[model samples]
Target: MSNSAYRWMVAVPAFVVVAAFGVYLGTTHGAPTALDRSVMDTVTGLRTPTLTSVIKDVTVIFSPVAVTIWTALLAAVLVWRDRSLVRALPVVATVAAAGIVGEAIKLAVSRPRPPAIDQLGAVEATYSYPSGHVMGTTALVAAAVSVCAASVGARVAAGCLAAATVVVCAATRLYLGAHWVTDVLAAICVGVGVALVVPVVLAAVIGRLAPHLPAWVGVPAANAGSKA
Candidate 1:
């Protein structure tokens, strides 16, 4: 099999494993238990005045606005370096696809958020099988990493940043009582699966368009320094 074929083969099994694991967790842990309550309370307790205020501010501040800003920044870098538009296309497309997929999965699962009547009061009525915040940030970070993967340092930094982003986003979701731990985990799996596929697809597109573009166009190193 070719490299692309190998990638797809790996991705398919990986996605299946993630989905199956998510289903297993969802079914086996249908409802929040005392342990869940204890854990949630612990997280909540750690939400000191400063931390709580920061979380609230950061969560609200980093909404779609931050996404847009980052996206534009990435695009600007590509455009500034006169890279092929094809190379930058995937960044936007993957993020959008992830959002849509996240919503669809949430609807299909139809898992309700943790009961508001319990310790952490509910805030929204949407299905919570997968967390949108986690999915969104995951997609963004993944796209950024893909665009910067040509260099060893870039790859390492991207991996670290992506991991940290996922953790922080997942923690924020749970602390805010917007989702159950299981839901966030499911979202991470789903987001990761999508993130893995998107860059490969974009790479193929860029490869095909490479001949038609200038020598500098689509050079991965050229855009490596740009924030994703």
Candidate 2:
């Protein structure tokens, strides 16, 4: 299917389905379900000092600030190498969409973090229905992977790294007792939707807007960042 069709047919449906799941969680008193609690306990129970140290580093590595810094570096490199920012638009758009949508849902849900009984890691003391850490990292990986290059092999490598980052980051959050299993899951789902939808939407906007420009803007995309 074409990108636009894929977004409408697949991405939009994914977003709706995940959104419904979020609503379900929100209505459930924000309590960890039995399964969620079980998973949280298992992950935290296995933590060691070495593991704790590793988890702490992952915490920072995937933090929103770190993700933004890395994203900027990636965009800078692309613009410098290509002498165009078109390749970086999807990366920027996805990150922006993720932050805005994640925050909106978080505040609307206002679900509290995992209870004190299960808490072991440093306190976040923030809403946790959909993990900000998970969402941010997910968007970062999705955007980075999507924009890293135009070659299939390069994109595949990027996908592998993105997947690994998401897994490790998600596990770190759960292992640290910073989030319920459901919180991370929901964030992943939501992030996937945003990653898929944002670039297509942004591309369409840019495509339409490009024609009316005064020729002072950046050149038309080589691939139009077409991978998105």
* lDDT of every predicted structure (CA atoms): 0.68, 0.77
Q: How many backbone clashes does candidate 2 have?
A: 0
Off by over 4 Å in 2: 214-228
Error of 2 at 179 (Å): 0.5
Report lDDT (Cα) of residue 26, candidate 2.
73
RMSD for all candidates, in order, please. 4.3, 2.6
Residue 110 displacement in candidate 1 (angstroms): 0.7
TM-score of model 1 vs. true structure: 0.76
| TM-scores, each model vs. reference | 0.76, 0.90
Writing each residue's lDDT as its tens digit, candidate 2 over 88-200 gives 77777788788899898888777888877667655778899788888988987887766664687877877888889899999988888888888898888778778877777
